[model samples]
Target: MGPTDTTHTTPLPVVLAGARGHGSWHLANIRRLQDQGVVRLAGVCELHPLDETELAAFAAEPPEQSADFGSLLDSTGARAAVICTPIQTHAELALTAAARGVHLLLEKPPAATLTDFERILTGVRDAKIACQVGFQSFGSHAVPAVRALVRTGAIGTVRGYGAAGAWVRDDAYYRRAPWAGRRRIGDTDVVDGVLTNPLAHAVATALELAGSGAAHDIASIETELFRAHDIEADDTSCVRLTTTSGLPVTAAVTLCAEQAGEPYVIVHGDRGRITFWYKQDRVLVQRAGHGPEETVHGRTDLLENLVAHLTHGTALLAPPHRTGAFMRVVEAVRNAPEPAALPSGAWHTAPALTGDGTRRVVRGIDAAVAAAADTLRLFSELGVPWALPTEVSSP
Candidate 1:
């Protein structure tokens, strides 16, 4: 079908895959957009039927629900699908949808490996359907503004880029699903770690700010992964990616934090720096001979972006091709040795923010993360006492 078939006058038919957990966010957004007459929620693919309470939210008219993705897409005649299934299932589900000539809003950490990512990329290309990878933060209006500044030399000669995110995830988080905190489940790679999953926006947005979202733009990646919790994957990690352009982008993030805070990316330059708190769509611009300029930006909804592309030839943001570099980082994490557990002296169990629970908090992760971003050093190379340097690189 073409834009003429999906004109603004006609609401695009879209289906939701995996409509529980984080998929609920898509449900709410779809319903909200549905009210505006831009799109319609045609069906849902879930392992089990949604309960009465869950079904009530779609009160406008119940959407078709089924366990089989292919059947759901065929029956609904949906033109697009949003895949928020587990990390390991992304490529499989995406290819399934693409085969049906369905566009996609695939969730972040698009696939567990670069090979899987490329497979999904090739499938979408061959199908000739739009696929918007869900790096929602890139939908922020501030992102383009920041990029324009870098392109026009508003940030001066760019030296490097860095992003920092320190957040708390309780033990219950891992138990929520079988795949949580796992690098590999059986033979399939999950790679669901702090860097690839929860704080992934930080990593992807940093690469965007550095103008290195394409896989070819990445020259090498050096990673120091560590875990403070008992999970299989790293909960706290740092990465230094040197782009083909010779610019470096560093990302330091933790699921175990002493104090939880917003995640942000910093654009470092000789003149000054630009700090973007991506979650809040906030920006801080500091340049030579100018007062600090800050603004909270509005965001473009990715779902609307997809529909606009189909209906009005609007540019698709966060497509799979733009996420190749981020996938390289995921591939590196997947192939890296099992993360080293932090020494007892380096961590402590803090009383949970809620009643009668506990969470792991690295003693000095906050400062160390800042130091790594500021100095372009990995935790081990930065001289943290309890840290031992273990670096893995990918060409």
Candidate 2:
């Protein structure tokens, strides 16, 4: 099973499920890889066939397009499936692909609940198919470099880590999808909060940096969830994950920022620290006795990694098992109390950049979020008068 293995010399046949919305990225990526002879987009499974506008961009004769996913796989004989569907549909669609012995590239925040996640994991394992979870940041080369620095004692004894993300999302963002900003849809748990949804990469990458990817690695979780928007989920949130060894990883994030900045995670050791801007695949390292060093790293596309794994003996970077600790965070958010709304006085409204409507700006949120991450304290603990104590429990 080496790169030179002749058994997999040809490009892998693949299907693109949910080929609209976020799946559109996959469609374009697949087309790009197809041109390089790494993989072939053999089929597309969508409720409706891609319209002329979407189809026109295909570089080659598009494969079969159909509404039935299982049928698409069988008909196209696709060996792999990339699923970028809704959060709730993930488990069922993934199971469908796994039952056919088709490998998978499932999107992030893997499933709606632990039960669904387990079901998908069990099915994929039983089928003996390679399943790569879609946390694209996991494929970033900078992530491993930082981890290696920590393990090599470049920063000394790891004290903990912190992450902060501030971004703006207007009414249109929530209106874009039915599940937007929802914690649960009927009996299903969406847990679409700021920490779990939009800024999840920061949280997941932090957990990975902490060397705590399994459920057992986590001892407890403390969550502070809030919303400035009229949605069912939190638009602003913070979480502290305490590992079994008592080290902490705290993250503060918001979708209703006065001014948006790049999201980042900082690994704080006793003598030094490392800051990683996950989106840019950038890293900054500072040790106790050395001047700071910064590096911008490249990323491996998850789809490309999946193809490599199938064609060669490459390891899947973001597998289901590696995301257990993250799913635990999702489970905690699901079981936690509803996100409290920020009082009107705590935030003011202003016209959004597009001049279409208004946006909520939580007063002093930027400083408050940074303080929480830097001090490894929750919002309430940081003396934010309007902030409430975090809800603490084992995840």
Candidate 3:
């Protein structure tokens, strides 16, 4: 890992901030791209330096590591940075990278609040550098395919959309870091809820499939937030949106599932429906006059897309502007009251097979989550026994 490759023929040198937690995935991905001659890991900004064991994958040319992010960027001359830091730090770090004219592959939930989202969105727009938010599902080729199907009336006329995510997270999962499940730390907002962070793709994808991925595209939103965990943020939640086009969208997600399974977004139409398991880039279409049809579409990695966008004039996917509508959802979750804790009998702890820790299981959550996506209804609307009253976010 070395200085920025100013020549277009050379690979872009990229620095990574927050090398622990979710950043580890970015580290391995960087190594893969480095092997492909797409980019170089120029430096790492971690509070504590990653030792040889942690840097083993980069043994051939270990990147410089430092605690001071700006200094590391200046010293390494990094042309781009993949930021997977805590939610509250995104705006400042993005501005810092922008000030240096460095491109960004910022992680999901790009900001903790609308103010910060707007700040970073404006700074990067003014900087005019390629800034791809880390909502990787947007890079799925199935996105266009699904959109094309809807446009051609492959699903007849579009009615609405829904998404479901049911994943298991044990008690230890929330203890992974100081900010792991916090909505706010002191006066700063973190908003690391189920919809805002871990399963954010479900929310953003449902909105995008409706051709409404901008701030103005969202006419209004209604949210139902709940948590089985002892932490501040919601581990189980859902949101319903009315787009400017009058299309309906909903996302139901829970980290307290009976079992972990692939998350998906579905488009509902009068004559048919299209289901996209975004993680696997898989799609299934079912309608009248035909049997069920399924296809696995190829996906474009967001970071790789950013590199190609810079070097080959390719279109940028998951750009900041493309996530404005998602930010509105984040804003709503932020202003909503703290997640209502599940009553004692509504959830029970069960030990995980892998032995990480005991997981909290919300009774019938898997079916409830799936039903919301299948019917475009929230948990309460579906009459789940433990659901709280819905909270509406003003337009």
- The 0-to-1 C-alpha lDDT of every candidate, in the order given, reads 0.89, 0.86, 0.90
Worst 10 residues of 2 by lDDT: 1-10
Q: Following a full C-alpha superposition, what root-mean-square deviation does model 1 have from the true structure?
A: 2.3
Cα lDDT over the full model 2: 0.86
Give each model's clash number.
0, 0, 0
**In model 2, which regions exceed 4 Å deviation?**
1-8
Off by over 4 Å in 1: 1-7
Over the stretch 149-179, how does candidate 3's per-residue lDDT look in tens digits?
9989898998899999999988988888898
**Candidate 3 whole-model C-alpha lDDT, 0 to 1:** 0.90
Q: Write the per-residue lDDT of candidate 1 for residues 190-263, one digit (tens) a residue.
A: 99999999999999999987778999999999988999889899999999999998988999999888899999
Candidate 2 TM-score versus the reference? 0.95
lDDT of 2 by residue, 279-325 (tens): 89999998878998999998888888887787776888898998888
1 or 2, greater by TM-score = 1
